[model samples]
Target: MLYQDHTSVVCKKQIFHTEFILRCHYYITTFDLYYTDQIQQTT
Candidate 1:
């Protein structure tokens, strides 16, 4: 029972980390695209 609980906690932690990384990546990509578009328009 203790092992199962520990495993569950680890799984949750992994999922949270994965989600955080994905969100950060998405925001960076979106910002880069927006900046690029603005630059193109100005030029």
Candidate 2:
């Protein structure tokens, strides 16, 4: 029973880590696009 609980905790951690990475990637991509648009407008 303890082992099963540990496995479940690990799985949850993995899911959370994956979600965090994806969110960071989305934010970075959005920022990059916005930055490019701003630069283009200035020139």
Candidate 3:
């Protein structure tokens, strides 16, 4: 029972971590695209 609880906790942490990484990647890509567009317009 204890082992099962520990595994569940680990699984939750891993899922949360993956979600955080995906969100960061999405934001970075969006910002990069916007910045590139602005630079292109100026040039």
Candidate 4:
């Protein structure tokens, strides 16, 4: 849960601060993404 929160926060900050959010769209599945925190995965 904590790691997920951190990833989310980082994701938000990355978009707010830099151009690193573009390459994130190639993620077809949540499991395949860079912020791949499986502890909070949903069905």
Q: Candidate 3 lDDT, tens digit per residue, 1-43?
A: 9999999999999999999999999999999999999999999
Worst 10 residues of 1 by lDDT: 1-10
- Looking at model 2, residue 10 earns an lDDT score of 100
Clashes of each: 0, 0, 0, 0
Give the Å error, residue 27, model 4.
31
After superposition, candidate 4 runs with Cα above 4 Å error: 19-43
Over the stretch 1-43, how does candidate 1's per-residue lDDT look in tens digits? 9999999999999999999999999999999999999999999
Task: Please say which candidate is ahead in lDDT: 3 or 4.
Answer: 3
Q: Between prediction 1 and prediction 4, which has the larger TM-score?
A: 1
Candidate 2 — which pairs collide?
Answer: none
lDDT of 2 by residue, 1-43 (tens): 9999999999999999999999999999999999999999999
In the range 1-43, model 4's lDDT, one tens digit per residue, is: 9999999999989787655455455444554663566544752
Report how far off residue 18 is in candidate 4 (Å): 2.7
TM-scores of the candidates in the order shown: 0.90, 0.96, 0.95, 0.40
Q: After superposition, which runs of candidate 1 have C-alpha atoms over 4 Å from their true positions?
A: none
